[model samples]
Target: MSRIGRLWNSLANPDRIPKLFAIVLGAVILIGFLIPLDLNVDQLYPRPVPQEQVEENISTAPYARGGEVLESPGITRAQYPENSKSLGWINSYMSPLAIWVASTSPYFGTSIYSSPGGLIDEILYYTRGFDTILESTILMMAFVIASWLGVNFTMNRKKREAEAAADKSKDYYDPTLNKNKTYYYNNQNSNIKEEQD
Candidate 1:
């Protein structure tokens, strides 16, 4: 068989299949958390709500300038959907969840994760960093478990080999010719000798 065939045979073994699946799953999770998807902001982002709605929703005091409510200009502010806003700033690459965490989180009292073209800056860098850490941890655990299983298999194989060798040696050279025939061979032999003598 070819090298590829041998490799496939080993991988297809039932004992190794679970370990292979774990490694693949870990890699996929790591990639999913690391790689950011490219998406259009206009399609995903919600329109800004008027300040009037904001005041009404929060039940906060109305803005007053010169004792005139009209002076506030009815400030218009961007409204970010719950758990999603920072995804708009797709600088180079950024994960959707990381962007969401950064956008929802407060930075300089603004909803955006960063300033200057809304680039994915420190906010995404740090937030996503945690996911990378978790992925690495899982990968490490898989490696350790696989290594341990390999060591155990090797040890068991060696032990069985040693036992087989001992059995063959006993069959070829037995100290007592009939020892294998009975569990109490030595006692029975002594009793027979005593009765005869």
Candidate 2:
């Protein structure tokens, strides 16, 4: 058969159903991470300062009293930056933070780059270090538990099968039949053989 036919048969097998489900679930999670969804910054950081209040405070501040304000604070929008895409969030916020750490940190300074490996390193070692560690530890513990359970299940099944086989063999044996068998005896003094039934 062809490779596709073999793969289809494997996927259809009951024993591989769980493994296939895990692969599909993992793929979905990977895709979700890779594809960034558009989100509102204001919704994420909802606390808003009034434009007038900010202007008054800046104008009254000692340094700003003499200097002119270059740009004025604009009106607060319910959702700021209309039609903003997901890339903006990464470029404006996450990338700068990651770049700063990659540049300044001695451990990551040399290896960190604008590549996928660098992004993974930044997440695993810097951004979400504790979370990554916890996730890995949890996955390890789950695997160990699953393996132990599987071993115990197979052992118990084998033990039960052996007991069943022993019981089946015992059903073929009869003590009454053995007792009724003819017995032959030799008499040494008389030099004669006797048979009893």
> What are the per-model numbers of colliding residue pairs?
1, 0
Write down the lDDT of every candidate, Cα atoms only.
Answer: 0.47, 0.45
Stretches off by above 4 angstroms in model 2 are 1-38, 42-115, 160-197
Q: Which ten residues in a row have the lowest lDDT in candidate 2?
A: 60-69
Q: Write the per-residue lDDT of candidate 1 for residues 1-197, one digit (tens) a residue.
A: 68887688667556689999999999999989878888765642223445642444422212111111223222222234344333333332324553464455423223343232222232334325466678789999999998897776654656654665668655554332334545476678768656633
lDDT, candidate 2, 39-122, per-residue tens: 776453233344543455432111111211223321222133443322121211225654475456533322434333333443
For TM-score, the strongest prediction is: 2
The CA-based lDDT of model 2 is what?
0.45
Please tell me which predicted candidate would have the highest lDDT against the true structure: 1
